[model samples]
Target: MTQSDFAAPSRYFVDESGTTGDLSRAGAGLDFKQQPVFALAAVGVDDEQGLADRLAQIRTRRFPQAAELKSSKGHATTTVVSELLDAIDALGGGILLEVMDKRFTLAATMINTLVMRPVSPDDHKPSALWFRMQLAEQLHDTAPVEVYDAFIQACRNPGEASLKAAFRAVLQLVPPETPRDSPAGAIRLFTLDSLKDYRKAGVSKPEVQRRFLPLPDLGHTGKEVWILPHLSAFTNLYARINKLRDGRLAEVHIVHDDQPYVAEILRSSKQAVEDLAADNKVMALARVDYRFVETGELTFTASTSSPGVQAADLIAGFAMRHTRDALAGSRPSLESLKVFHRLANTLDGAPGFGMNLMLSNRDVLRCGLLPSQVPPMQPS
Candidate 1:
């Protein structure tokens, strides 16, 4: 083991709001539309026992009967959140929260798979990400219902056949009626043409075809494979942990709430980061955040057993509720907004380190968050 391994590593506890599920499922009851946002929060504490004691004290004072505290139980009121935030600050801990708009993420995923990814591994470039944001927005708005329906179906029964059908649907898209000369029409046409060309190239490359499809066992597992905002959010949070420390020598050990279904996938993702960090060729193209995470793997514990995870639950609940309200075009309460500002202040002005938002530009604009706090899109 390295010398740094002997040093006490910073510990973080993680919990998530908006359970990960296939967003394509639609019916009279639509979770994606109702929830709209997925949120993950991690709380780092230098003094675990102190944090735990504080949390226990808060519960005793607030809810004398409850065995455990949970935000999902409608217990993360403004007063409770304020106290939790205070305890976090008092214990020299910081919180990181990641929120994503499910619909916007779905649109971006399609563009990422069909448009941005290169046919050959060697042809990938950072510049390809420079302009896809606008295309994702255009595709999300102008796409035919058939296209979305097909993609949803593919997510349900993911395979080579389903992916091919969905990609073909995209390639053969006849955009909805719009004035040909109008700016909107021009964008739709441009998006359609771009997707057709890129997806065509993607389909022809047999070696990388599965990259365009879901995980081989997605249907059987019923786990979320496509449009994984939770995974993206967690990766960003992990990166933020390294960034906040500004040194790779200090190890980071995070204990996340036990998620049986996604545990293996998260470990695999961590291994990919470990592998990519060591590969000179890949690291040359990857961003700075990809490096400096010293921890080799994650540990999981139930929220009930971990104070840090419980603290994270409160923050995630606040973040999810406020963002959902903003997305639905409803004004948030002044108290809620105050707690948000307090949460924002915890980062000490580093934008993406404390809070990350993965919403479309339109959703962001209406979300009532400050312009400076919105995270700039990072290259994939």
Candidate 2:
């Protein structure tokens, strides 16, 4: 198969963060630097909703009570791997999973290099920006090689445009000297500022901060890749649905998971999502569901007797809870997106403040939120 072979459908980008356990708490007493495993993955889909719904059906045992599906585990640290896998399977897509190796200290080092470090005097830039670009390139490069090769091989011929876009997205990151007008350049510029702003706002360090740069924008972009091929199909379906007078052409569907930190990641990543949405000019839609996988009230032995049932029940209950919460009220609607300058004084102390600030603002614009809308808050 070659890039010249197949016709592209509406495409989509799909991704997954975390897995089935509470790895965020893996560092209970250890140095903040030491943490267990967490994973983030991105996949391209031809039919996002259909894929999501199909996966939900397969995992129906996992979410019995969700009024509507949502794809987050409403906590500060955990990844819902099962739900993520279901999503991948349902969408008929391939994945690029980023797993933190237990033996590698790279995760922590990378975080410090990107997030904890205030500014980079050496480059007169924020380390975060550099780190984000590097990370995005790495993931983009490795993932397609490891997983998408099969997809590529399976295709009799793939669309040249998509293949070129995907290849360009990855290639732009490597060689380090690639021109700045590429996707790699965009990622680097976007991430640096995002981290800087996050710190300025005094947002508490996320569990993964010490081990990962937390480039939510990259994750969102990955999802876009999964969705792009299927855009035309979705648009047509949406148009027909509108003719029926059901409601908005856009539909928000969620994939439910039972990981606690998934929700927090989703929340924290909200800024990144908004950034990607704007950069890509697409309506962003996502939600995360988190709940306890264990029944503290029941004895371990009793719970073990019906592990499947217990897990399913817990997930369902949590989904309903979240649905109710979303119905209760709305968050501020995203009216517009823009980038602005941060007072140099506001950025003074941060080591890589300048670079970080610039990238963050860019990401905000990319995600479809106005940088000016983010109020300044001091770092914790």
Candidate 3:
């Protein structure tokens, strides 16, 4: 069937909260500290109007007064989220729920060591290294092998594991055929405070600076500095979300209590959506905020808006766009064209090739241009 003949994919709404230990200091506040639980939940809605109605019910249940609603309080917030999941499940939609018992400190540590820090040159070693150190400090008598095996297993299959193991156990609650592999229509929920704590504890500014800075003789005098911890936190979150999206979980809607933290994530999400859409030749139809029915809290939804393009279509368009652009405005010999074609075919595994081609100079040069062009067409 043609793309138009297919139904729009189902949508998943996701939100996260309660992962950090010191709630008092976190953006979500002291109440979250008491729970020290971090949760990521997803709920599927049939359509935009249905989503709005459900959110209204959640809002009425959680907050009678819109003015008094705050994003960080766990008690009412938890109830709203729990109720929303129940409603979605009752309606035969999918639900994913995961909760972590570790102190926010420990969870933060794990996120840092596992997800955030590995991309850094200094922390590029196996994830087991830091995990072992943390386990030794916490359990004392536990063997590293046990911890390593558990961690790897959890990462590979979050649906089977508890939030305590991988923080992704919520997926288990979802229906097995929930269409997680769809291009569009997956909703994701996230909490920013937990991510912030993890970033602050796991990464150091000096480390990033050291890696990015060039030696004096290299002629790069200024050091690349990132002062705001939120920058890296959101950046990491964006990467993680895209990873999920690439894996076929679309329609990600995040719920975060901390306004500032949520705001940053929104900003990053907006940029990501725009960049991805533009690079892929897809359009972002809409991003709007609505109240949660249970809590009377406001949440945001980002949608493709139009009926024409599926999420995968957008991705494909981006690839085609880049390929076209790469092939345009250049005169390459037959051999050079062959090399470009081979390189493009090999790198097809790369996500958002069109976007990557446009945004990344390296990919454009490598995939679009001939290798012989390097070093003034020096022979291989």
Indicate which candidate wins on lDDT. Answer: 1
TM-score of 3: 0.31
Q: On residues 1-380, what C-alpha lDDT tens digit does candidate 1 reach at each position?
A: 22132222388888999865555653233346477788898887868889889988999999878887889888788888999988877776677777777766766666655445445544334444434455566666667667766776766665556766776676566446876465345444654664566366674565445555434323326555554566667766766665556536346688899887777667766666666656633322222255644653488998878888888898899888888988888988889888977775564644224566667677766766664422333323
- Sorting all predicted structures by TM-score, with the top scorer first, yields 1, 3, 2
TM-score, model 1 to reference = 0.80
**Could you estimate the TM-score for every candidate?**
0.80, 0.26, 0.31
Location of the lowest summed lDDT over 10 successive residues in candidate 3 = 371-380
User: Which residue pairs collide, candidate 1?
Assistant: none
For 66-109, candidate 3 gives per-residue lDDT tens digits of 43222342223334434543454345443222222222223233
lDDT at position 231, candidate 2: 21
Q: After superposition, how far is residue 213 of candidate 1 from its true place, in Å?
A: 4.0
Two-way TM-score contest, 2 vs 3, winner? 3
